[model samples]
Target: MWAELIQEVRVAQTGVQILFGFLLTVVFQPKYGRLADTDQAIYIVTVVMGACATGALVGPVSLHRLVSGHRVKPRAVRLASRMTLVGLALLLATMTSSLLLILRVATHDGYVPYLVTAVVAWYVLCWYALPLWARRRNRGGSGD
Candidate 1:
């Protein structure tokens, strides 16, 4: 369980690290200054979310390191799993906000919000719904 959790965290950690690194550089770009106040606010929120996601995704490794010698593998695995979930959620928010900001700046279309909504729904379905559905569908029959 711990190994599986670590693998999952590794994937999320890499993605969030890349995103946070990119977000950190955005502020120094000359075009950043030309953004409208609302866009600027969105950028700030997105950056913060990216930071949080990075931390949550990276937390499992730190947690494991600190608790390694305590003979608490089960507890550590549970906590790591929770952190990964939070990280994924934060990643979702960060992506949504980033998309919103990009679309708003690229094209001030009235359909921006609707499009973002559709994409978010798709993300939720892909990231969470399918796995949950699979679990529920196979729960009893597998006899694990």
Candidate 2:
């Protein structure tokens, strides 16, 4: 369980780290100042969300390191899993906000909100709904 959790965390951690890095750089770009006040606010929120997600995704590793040899692997794995879920949720928010800011700046169309909503719904379905459905469907099946 620990190994599997670590593997999953690695995938999420890499993504969040890259996203947070990019978000960090955006503030220094010249165009960042040209954004509207609302877009600037959105960018700020998105950057904060990215930072939080990166922290949550990296938490499992720190948890494991600190708890090593404490005979608490199972408990650590559960906590880490919870952190990963939280991280994923934050990542979704970050992505949505990033898209909203980009679309608003690029097109200024009335459909941007609807388009972002659709994309977010798709992400929720892919990232949460499908896995939840699978878990429920397989709950009574063979353990293997």
- TM-scores of the models, in the given order? 0.96, 0.96
lDDT of 2 at 111: 100
Model 2: which ten-residue window has the lowest total lDDT? 135-144
Off by over 4 Å in 2: none
Candidate 1, residues 86-141, lDDT tens digits: the string is: 99999999999999998999999899999999999999999999989988999878
Give candidate 1's TM-score. 0.96
| Location of the lowest summed lDDT over 10 successive residues in candidate 1 | 135-144
Relative to the unseen true structure, what is the Cα RMSD of model 1? 1.2
Q: After superposition, how far is residue 132 of candidate 2 from its true place, in Å?
A: 0.6
Where does candidate 2 clash, by residue pair? none
Off by over 4 Å in 1: 141-144
